[model samples]
Target: MAQTTELTIGYFTVIFDEHTGWTGGLLVLNRGGRPVEFQCTLPVRPSRAHEILFGTTLRDHLIGEVIGPILIKKCRTPLSMVCCDQAESLSLSASGGVPVALVGEAAENDEGPITNDMLVGASRVKLAGATLHVPIEHTETVEGIAGRFVDLVDAVEPFERIREAIKEAQSQISRAS
Candidate 1:
């Protein structure tokens, strides 16, 4: 099979409900923010024993280690970078072998630390609008990917789509049961 070099980005998020422990969805989009592929995992409700064993790290482990990789691996389209809203999901970078980042609003104080911020689009754009948290090693990769679509795609928009998709998926699952 021929390898595809299209610039694709993956957005991942997990929603947790009292009944459903964690339901994660990964939405793959082209540079223009068009949906390429989407994969959602079955709800994973960790047992009480597992929660006790994991302690405070339960969410990070469940979302990052367990759910995130499964969704990412199932994606048929090749992704250049994976963007997530949760810091816990940043761990997907290491496990999934793709540059992962946490997208959020930048800090108000410009004098603060810029060490971890991933600037999207033009350098002239206000830095306080959106920032991405990526591993130190993957900084360049994430920046390069973000730069390409900075003008075309809003960094925070795809996440909203993922959230809506998860809700839709959950409703379907609920209706079936």
Candidate 2:
């Protein structure tokens, strides 16, 4: 049997509302940051096929369009018909407020199932088949990196814009690949 390599992929970013004191962030948890990595901020909008394929109502469509591509790209699979918005919201929270990592892999029937932990901390990621979701607490770090991000949020506007641009560039690169 041929061995399949696990791919570490995720989408992460920082968002800020200078006037409202609101901020959000996401980090796609992969093994490490890399040239083959995926992360970005794209204008996520709904498509007609989204409803039919995913069994999503108009309301659901509205929310999914905003973050669907991120999840799909990270998972390296087609979007699910029924999405757990709570999980998606958690992902956005990670994107805007703290560092969040969403991770996944395509499963081969010849191999095993994929879980959420594959993207975040190995101890925290939970996966069912090819679908995966990570817990918020998984952002915990022994080195206090997340704390720095939280403290730096206010000072991270320029860096955040750059991060967003990088994510866009990464997405473009994936499409090109």
Candidate 3:
């Protein structure tokens, strides 16, 4: 399929540091992979009680329930679809919001049942030369949303930028204190 529509794509991720808690960054890109908007959350350090209560689900709750939603809300541009690199953030797609996917290497998307909206897992989708583990039924949506631009985006690159930005922010905060 060819990309006929002018589309905007969003790459969102949450990074964690044991010393500073968690920080999230969302980068929205146009069809040309240019930045349209970027937003980040301050470090969210939970109490020991929260850690005990959430346990294994702590990461998911923080990234998916807290940080991911706020980052999405802060975006000014209307994103045609969202891409993430981690499993914890996958819960963001369940909101019935714009299409959200966990983008990974093509080799990672093993052939299997595609997880539906009601389910808690993901379905692997091959897009461009990469693998997109999308929530619900976003495989085709991404194929069309990306179109020619899909070839232009090395989806993992934006995440590196976001991570660097967040780390710099943390350093800045430490220096200011």
Tens-digit lDDT track for model 3 on 11-125? Answer: 8888778898888999887767777788999989999999999988887799889999999887777778888766666677777378887776411111343234423555666
Candidate 1 achieves a global lDDT of 0.73
Q: What does the lDDT read for residue 63 in candidate 3?
A: 82
Is 1 or 3 the stronger prediction by lDDT? 3
lDDT of 1 by residue, 40-127 (tens): 8888999989989998888879888999989987788898988777767877877888988776552122245333343333122211
By lDDT: ranked, best first: 3, 1, 2
Error in Å for residue 43 of model 3:
0.3
Clash tally, candidates in order: 0, 21, 0
lDDT accuracy of residue 120 in candidate 1: 37
For candidate 2, give the lDDT.
Answer: 0.34
Give the least accurate 10-residue stretch of model 1, judged by summed lDDT: 119-128
Residue 161: error of model 2 in Å? 8.7
lDDT of 2 by residue, 1-177 (tens): 121243322333323222322122233332233223233344333355865777634333333335443444444322111112123333443333323333234221112454344334423333332222435464343123322222221221223443566556545766997
RMSD of 1: 5.8
User: Which candidate number would show the highest lDDT if scored against the true structure?
Assistant: 3
Clashing pairs in 3: none
Model 2 lDDT at residue 73? 43
lDDT of 2 at 55: 64
